[model samples]
Target chain A: MVDIAAELKRPKIDAHCHVRAGREEELSSQRLVEAGEMLGITEYWCSRPITARYGSLEEIRAGNDAVLAAMRRYPQRIRGLCFVVPGYYREACAEIERCLDAGMIGVKLYHQYKINDPAVWPVIELCTQRRVPILVHAGYVTDPRTKAEQPRLSHGADFAEVSQRFPETMFIMAHIGGGGDWEWTLRALRDSSPNVYVDVSGSNLDDGQVEFAVAELGAQRVLFGTDGTMAGCVGKVIGASLTEEQRHLIFWGNAERLLAAQGKQPLAKIESGQEGVAG
Target chain B: MIFDINAWVGSWPFRSLRDSTPQQLTERLRKAGVAGAAVSQIEAILHRNAQPANERLAESVEPYRDVFVPMATINPTYARWEDDLRICHEELGMKGVRLFPEYHGYEIDGPLAKRVVAACRERGLPVQIPHRIEDMRQRHHLDPARGVPLAAIAGLVAAYPDTPIIVTNARGIAQSPLWRRTELRDAAWYADTSLAEVYFQGLDKDLALIVEESGGRHLLFGTHAPFSYPEAALVKRATLPADADTLEEISYRGAMRLGLTPESWAVKAGSA
Candidate 1:
């Protein structure tokens, strides 16, 4: 058996993580960083889960504040994303400015409105002008419950439409494995420009899913993301049918390139001596 | 040695997959420390009649009897499904039979299904139901196949409490409330780990919960290989928080309920 703990020591970055401040059941900054250290994750790009927990504008601000606070607390290990409810256009834009002013690198959008809805155009345009990537919640609409809750939730086709409309904006389709028709989503995005990328996160670990993503989008277009767990994300990449270089790209290299594009530097690198330490 | 209850052989037309042939698959499994797998053919799920593909599967695994246990697919919708089951048990000596109700365009509670279930019970053969052959989202664009409904499967399990019934490729059902149903929990029904991954808050809580609720004896280790990487399942298995004995039960012992024994597989002399 592969020593997963040992394999995790290789420097990596989790591009998609949720920080639940004040919620002990959820991950705190200290716990998140500690988990990252054990799993070889050098940095985490975080958004606040509180925004989704409570949908009011005040709660949304609180969520963004939590991300900012976590980033401040763990400057070396945490990166912040400005969480916005696109329906509240002005407040959303203001929050984006506040996060960017505070050195947050990107934007994280949830299911407040459809990805392609006209109301979200301003936020997309702002992020495009700022040259920051927007990580959108694009999951499969499987059952009645999900369909009812997120009637306008973005799928692969919707994401494709959004990416096409704003070619300059970099959009990360969150959860390529999140229970919606991923195959349809992948195929829909197959011909999409390089501006569109995917995050390998979410709860579903269907076999060959990572490989399928890599095959369809190429390693460069796929970024390693753990919807908030190192073990979940790390295992998918580590257990994939990938070479050392491909694994490195998914684990850290691809994320590094994305972060570097935003003028951010990883806090640390996996030293050559650290390779295969646990193995 | 891991025993994968949900491995497959044969090409998938929808997407390109590695390790399709028996040799490629076994080499892949062996590298991941998989000692054996109960495998079926992908063609069985795609074809109108699954008998030809079933025969091919038996023939393909004949050369590697020690590692690959052939599980034949019988489409009850087909006219010759009874003969197919007989050939699988009497002729090929297959201990398990897989049914693809959705792919075959039939419901699990249909009269045909009742007949098939009765036959398997009479013959002392285990019936395996694959809830979803491919992630419905990733299935061939033109082929609009979906998984067998969880309720339908529960009804069938309720009807035949005495027969050994294993559900494979059921990632969604395992996470649902139905997984904890008293009727299912009381019956001789088992679930394969092919689609049972649960990643939440840095913990594999779904797997832990399933093992806790169903008991380790009701879970079987499955990779859904060729369609999925064997290493993925092995990695999940390794990370399961269960003790060594419980892990042993999930990996191999649970499968013994289907009447498989280590001695039943004949490893050729000098074979790796």
Candidate 2:
């Protein structure tokens, strides 16, 4: 009666989808919600425009508001995470402040802006001061990742300095460090930084890093994030290590805790994240 | 009711024992809600001779006896090809034989490859061959040599139209409308859900076209183990937007059609 079955049947969260200023520009947030519903994915955190040229506060707000509008259409199923280039901190911080006021839960950093660069240092300061999690694109750039992975933002190596600089701030490394130049990224996640949590998004876990990561960093640290393409979501999660209880955590429990702590409501149904199109 | 024709049961050198064991793998299969699977050995593919590995594979099928069927890997290049096929057929009762022509380094049209394909045909055996596992680029080589061409396999299937040959490694089937143009009507292909899926490439016409052209009976669910996660394939197969009848044909009956039961296989000269 708890609708646990329906909730269990709910779609997975696509932690890193994009708006592209085109794909979803005119489509109603309801259609976006429908897309998520069809796939049983209830959440979409838009993080495209990850480049230096996308270095304006206005660009961040446009993408951020697009995602927020989707969330508004299906309040229970959507949440928007803001994207910013670390090279422009004041601009990035200004957008983050706006997103925070609008109830965003996390900050997204593209590798185009070096994590170690002074430009991003202030963005981290802002996110940390506000206690929002920052997700970074960490992995090898040349490893022939699918076309969905673009703009080889600096690998996890760029951010080792950032994590060291701010130990209390939460850092989520997308792809769990195995995408490319993975070993060092894994090393950083496991040893170099305490607040760093790795997600198996848009990466292959076939090499046993998922279990190893769970062993090194508790299951709580491995957040589930897919690059948000249909196939990417399936491939990333199908190969993870969480047991029945833990899968619930990676899928939603952990996200629910993080969102609730920030005053957000968990999606109650499987249709919350549906894309609006019927085809 | 969903049958996963392309899955594996054996220890993988790199993947942990959890996804490799029969019990663990079967449970994982069941979790995907597949009714049955046609299993082969990943460990055997590593065997240099493919004899002990074939023998080892036949034995691996014991635990999942009810829900699983055996597939033997044959390296006809091995000096004992005749003996390996005998043991695989008579002793272990494997339903089919899988070949790795690339790893074995033989052309599908070559004498040895044709001989193995013919041997299975003579004994009413279904033959399977994996093209390549994992993203070929991610594998050991940097863009390893191309798999035995689908056209080449089309040639083999055309040669022996009576024998059912299931090719597991052909990534080209989903893209080629030529599957409809093939002269081999008795010939068919199995889509390893692992390799069957198209990703960020944004090209998904292959599966739809193949399903339509082959009338769905030509498709079977397979997962190239140690190469891809089986659950992903299952999800892909389940999510295929085909009609109910077509879905049943591809997911379940197609594999059964590829199989030769003990009775049919046991049919001998005296009975004939």
Candidate 3:
């Protein structure tokens, strides 16, 4: 069998990750970097951790502060995503501006509101104007047994609806393999505009999930991410039945290109002092 | 050589799976360096009468006994389940029996399930319970049932301590509190790596930890083949941070404890 960890020596970037402070244990920046080093990850684009309840504007600011601090502490190993709870539109817009001014590259939306909810339009419009990507928490509906009374989750179709409305904005359907409706998610994103991409994050490792995504949406549209565990994410891609070129594209190239398109530099090139190819 | 404890033949009702036929499956497994696999029939999970599926599985693997070990599925929900178990053990010569209580609409700890377990114990046959064949979330729109509950499995484990019970297709079972319970931890309950793989940082420490917790002898290597790429599971096993002897135990010896010996079971179909 191929030694995937040994063979993959290129600089890789995690397009989806979180940096948290306070009670959260696993989402700390130190933990993310420690885990990243094990999987040969060069950099990570991180968002703030969201709680089960709707966080106040002050809570969102504190989360973004942790992200910005991580980017500052590990200048070349971390990038920031200003997390927003779009229902607090005025406060979310202000926080987005504050983080973007601090050199953060994108926006991260959690389950505070649905993707298609009209309340999120201002944030979507802001992302489009700035050419930054938005990684949204989207998944299939819960099983009837575990279904909550008022589930405010977003599905693939919801992402499609938002992506169509904001054609210029790059929308990442986080965790295409997440939840029961991943197949439905992939199909919904297949015909949507090129601005939409899928991240291979989350805990669900269904067989042939990555291959199916690559086959349907093309390798360029799939980005590698570890919702947390670096080894699990790397194993998912490396153990997949993909060509070396396809593996490279998913592991690093696609992320590099996506960041570049947003006028952002991956920490690897910045740390190596390489020429600004994108610029 | 890797001996895969979980693999399937025939079509799944939900999605299109590659390598469904015996030739295709064995070839795929062989290419991935898997020496042999214990295969069950997909129809058994969906069909009301598991006898035909078991017979079909035996016939399908008759020619390839050198590489395929048939594991007959016995749904306790069906009538004459004991007779089915008899046929599976005597007529079909299957090395073990597999059950899908959730899919078949029977409780794992119910009387019918107990009878099936008793029969397998009497025959010295191992019982393989698939927590689920497909991810509950990813099941076909029509099939809404979830995987067999861990509590039911725990009850069954407590009920039958001597029966070699192997759980297949259970992802993340290692981290569950049930895995740590004294009743389950001390029992001869085993798990396959098909869905139990967990990785942190750059190491496959989750699998290694599972081996340590379950005793290296209690964990078996399985691919959940056809539904998953055979190489995926093989890569996980090969990459695990374990010593050669421990790896050997997980790859083959663990199943040997369940009486699935390649020497006895894999000698070209009829000559044995």
The top-ranked prediction according to DockQ is 3
> Which portions of model 3 miss their true places by more than 4 Å?
A1-11, A23-38, A68-77, A145-150, A229-233, A269-279, B199-208, B238-241, B264-272
Quote the true-contact fraction of every model.
0.24, 0.10, 0.25
lDDT of 1 at B150: 75
Candidate 2 lDDT: 0.62
- Enumerate residue pairs that collide in model 1: A140-A180, A181-B137
Rank by DockQ (best first): 3, 1, 2
Chain A accuracy of model 1 expressed as TM-score:
0.91
Per-residue C-alpha lDDT of model 3 across residues A117-148, encoded as one tens digit per residue:
99999999998988889898777754664235
Q: Model 3: per-residue lDDT, tens digit, B120-214?
A: 88899998898877666555667754788777777888889878888887766656544756666777788887766545432234565776655
Q: Write the per-residue lDDT of candidate 1 for residues B108-155, one digit (tens) a residue.
A: 877888889999999998888887766554344566557787778778
Q: Candidate 2 at residue B174, lDDT?
A: 56
What tens digits encode model 1's per-residue C-alpha lDDT throughout A1-279? 555546755677788988875554245677677666566677888887432332887887788788888888888888898988887889889989998999899999888777889999999999998888899888775555556666766877777887788987889998776656676678788657677889888655655778778888888888888785345456677778787777777877777777777787666755654544321
Of 1 and 2, the candidate ahead on lDDT is: 1
Give per-residue CA lDDT, model 2, range B139-175, as digits (tens).
3333343466776777777777677777774555655
Q: TM per model?
A: 0.82, 0.73, 0.88
**Which pairs, if any, clash in model 3?**
A180-B137
Cα lDDT tens digits for candidate 2, A1-279? 112223324446656554445355435344445445545566766555535456556666777777666556656755667877766667778888888788677888766755666777788888888877888766644434432345545555655677788887777777652345344466555444666777766534343455566776677767666553344345435555457566555665566656654566555542333412111
